[model samples]
Target: MGNNNGRKGPGRREILKSAGAVTATAALMSAVRASFPGGAFAQAAGPETDKVTLGFIALTDAAPLIIAKEKKIFDKYGITGANVAKQASWGTTRDNIVLGSASGGIDGAHILTPLPYLMSLGTVTAENKPTPMYILARLNYQCQGISVSNEFKGLDAKADASPLKEAFAKKKAAGKEVKCAMTFPGGTHDVWIRYWLAAAGIDPDKDVSTIVVPPAQMVANMKVGNMDAFCVGEPWNDQLVHQNIGYTACTTGEVWKDHPEKTLGMRADWVDKNPKAAMAVLMAVMEAQQWCEKMENKAEMANIIGKRQWFNVPPADIIDRIKGDIDYGDGRTVKGSDLLMKFWNGGVSYPYQSHELWFLTENQRWGKLPMDLDTKAIIGKVNREDLWRSAAKNIGAAEADVPKTTSRGKETFFDGKVFDPADPKAYLASLQIKKVA
Candidate 1:
């Protein structure tokens, strides 16, 4: 009885409606919420279930989920023994989340922030039937890189990618296709590289081929001269520079300062089925984000995630840029830069509805989504900021520390483009290099 997508269809409600099991389930969740008013479910009050399988790619931003499991914070919050499985790629992660753990896949994941929305709308799924996903928290801000091959080393594109337009033009005129790789279609990396190229007057869709490459494969693909430029999360980008294969043009944060990246996303049905357990898992991951954001934790964090069982990367590849030290690999170096990744810098991990709007708008500009799509209604269905708020208070976050508003006000990008969440259509109309006319 599987659906056209990875998940099974005609759920428990359909099969058990006459048995009253669904009613009992709802009653249990209501009772649990009443007992734990702050949303902090611990061992004493207990959870409906003690385990769920979560997935993550080998990116540094997946640290919160791994740290929670490694440090037994999940155990502390009554989500004891939750599995943090490693995903081979973003596409696999999507399929698995749809499949759910009971069906031999995953329950949730450290996913691209835009992906949950796309999946929820069924835009990227096989039959275009919504998966009903939920974005619980933004995992990190910044630290993704747009890197160029050493062939363009002299160009040194820097923050403005205009320098590479001529080189790309020459490549195209030579009767060869120019390729730019990103981790997933309509995901953060795709949007970033597209924005970078379009800002320089290069058409990402028409001027160059946008290919899908997993984050882990980006370095090897570049080493073999498979792509001219790529956008991805660390520690792969740092590894590229270490191998002398490429130099980073700019960290994504430079393009749009404090930009949202990965997210802790899960199937909405899972949250509904296990409300208390979901809150417990959210609280544990939030606590881990706080620990991961500390300056002193950088070395240890790098060492832990670098182990073969995890990212299998070298700590040296991860530690440098993680602590704000950068070696651009083209004779430019920065010490203690502000462009380092932020795990829980104040409300950095809060899932702002405003940030999600920009992602949808960017996807619209590129034709991945319909221009007339109901962005606000979709955001309302997919973003569970209310759940995030509950977890924050229960996790002992000071009231002052919690964000009062869902919007981060207006966001401005490097090329002087501004995205006011209040006027996404205006932002879309202002873009010169877009698929939308």
Candidate 2:
């Protein structure tokens, strides 16, 4: 979606330029590695498999995977043939992971945080065959947004959708629909939009039609009037504003600050067969996340991921949000904010079970999971925090970097509602709008 109409592949001239850049980056990383005690590139017991393919969708949050490949971090960790292939949509990502690498699919992916759980529960699988999966680390937090078309211009709406509900009702009476789009049905984007809509007394299930659109295709779809509003990760939301097609109503962080977004997910079978390799991949991504979190590296990161092969968006569009320079596209701007997308800072890389539990509860709220389901058992099997701890130790991460507790305790949302991990059911009951059947 970043204007790749004429490009087939990088021309010879472009290839040479990329090669030179890689060479310079390699030299820089080599010096940094040498300075660290025992060297960051020092290999432990070699990985079980030397090659592994991973899938990613075209979103800014997929930077960790791209950075790992570009900076040779995967190779340093002995994952020699690590491939970060781009995926068309979240549904395709699920199918490919279900197929597995032996069947010519990816062994892992930079995936929506809840997708691996859905896959493991046979919720999204075509054949209803559960594909066991594990979340190695959380890739990012925040930086997703809900954008509304020009039709809602000058509307006094922030976190509340009350202003839009009457408009939607009038449209419905006229046999027209007010639709909202998200990347996946039960994903973070969907949940965010749903929460925002419900907070304003608009029932997401009954008041509006919800649809799925891939991240890269969001702007194009919106431009052609496929949907009235959409919630997705950047830079599609930012692009909509740049093109004057829509304006960001509010960011997900504004809805709930520092909320978990994406994850580095892999098949549980693959991890079982290749424990050391899984740890190696985790270490590589962890280092890449740390590198991406640095203030100085953001511009370079935006440039690298904005290339045609990755996100395919312009660097200018991606750089602002990464640096916390947010333009809400409705005559509002924030020079910088701590609520920007986080890769490693604020214990973001650590996969908190409490967050996963919240996601699970939301899925249940939306009728994606049964209310009576044993959530703790499902979380135990899917969340491999033990592997994360082991990987952190092997990588010589500081003790403070690793959390002493698995849970981040009770989390409070922008709506003044609290989600206590210890009492998930009560939290669910307190929500006025839910479809927990």
- Compare the candidates by lDDT and give the number of the best one: 1
Q: Candidate 1 has which clashing residue pairs, if any?
A: none
Give per-residue CA lDDT, model 2, range 128-242, as digits (tens). Answer: 7899999989999999989998888688566676788888788889998889999998998999999999988889899899999999999999999889889999998889999
Per-candidate clash tally: 0, 0
Q: Could you tell me the lDDT of residue 108 within candidate 1?
A: 95
Each model's lDDT: 0.89, 0.87
- Tens-place lDDT per residue, model 1, 1-437, is 22335446656655664344454344334435644677665333457788989999999999999999988777766676699999999999999988888899998999999999999999888788889999999999999999999999999698899999999999999998899999999999999999999999999988999999999999999999999999999999899999999999999999999999999999999989888888778888898999999999999999999999999999999999999999888888899999999998679889999999999999999999998899989999999998888778666686655889999999999999999999998998989999898
- Scored by lDDT, model 1 comes in at 0.89
In model 1, what lDDT does residue 114 have? 97
In model 1, the Cα lDDT at residue 101 comes to 86
Q: Each model's TM-score, in the order given?
A: 0.91, 0.90
RMSD per prediction, one decimal?
A: 10.0, 7.6
TM-score of 2: 0.90
